[model samples]
Target: MKQATRLMALAALMIGASTAAGCGTSAPVDATGLRRVVGTDLIGARGATAADQRKIDRTAVGLCAGGVWSKDECERHGEGAR
Candidate 1:
């Protein structure tokens, strides 16, 4: 039937589009996860200050907005502050 063929084509197009969209998309990351995304050095270097730490914390909060990861994601990655 023409209607059945058209529906099948539309379904195939939708599936192909969704798959193609993710072709260029990278996986999302948490705070600990971000170290893997951007690297541990950059995250630590820029996260040294109270203000900078706050920025990292905020970004982590946004990343794990749904509580997907624990609070440590927003905490300092190193031993202690200087």
Candidate 2:
């Protein structure tokens, strides 16, 4: 019936909205990300590849956005990875 179709469409719209919201969410700063930030900040990303460096940078941004690290601190440490 038209009522059933309307309900199904509403459900689909909600599901799609949730999926899009999730995709927009940034990756969390987890334990591994923290370790990488600390290691690279203290020692340096001397042996890290370009991709690894990029990951570290992204982790720093996540940490900053999550209030784990201050923007100045992240910048001072070169995005938490020297």
Candidate 3:
């Protein structure tokens, strides 16, 4: 009876650990937020001139395109092409 109880406790502990491990694996992607951060990092705090801003936008689009962002979204931002 004690051995059975110990086995049950071990099974419960394994289940709990598996559930906790799965919890950290499923975060949603924030594409718009990512783009904004990338743009700001590329541009600068004071901001850029029209030409510079265009360049920054293109670079941001390219960066996002290489990752999870869809082709349509990347094109909308003007970074669609390789």
Q: Count the backbone clashes (under 3 Å) in each candidate.
A: 0, 0, 0
| Best-fitting candidate, scored by TM-score | 2
Q: Which ten residues in a row have the lowest lDDT in candidate 1?
A: 36-45
- Candidate 2 local lDDT, 8-45, one digit each (tens): 43345435644554564695444454344333331233
Better of 2 and 3 by TM-score: 2
Q: What pairs collide in candidate 2?
A: none
lDDT of 1 at 80: 34
Give the top-scoring candidate (lDDT): 2
lDDT of 1 by residue, 1-82 (tens): 4323323433454356445545656843323543333232223325335665554444444434544334674343222322
Worst 10 residues of 2 by lDDT: 38-47
lDDT of 3 by residue, 1-82 (tens): 4323323433454356445545666764544544453343343312234554455455445455546345774565453223
- Global lDDT of model 2: 0.46
Model 1: CA > 4 A from native: 28-82
How many residue pairs clash in model 3? Answer: 0
Model 3: CA > 4 A from native: 1-48, 79-82
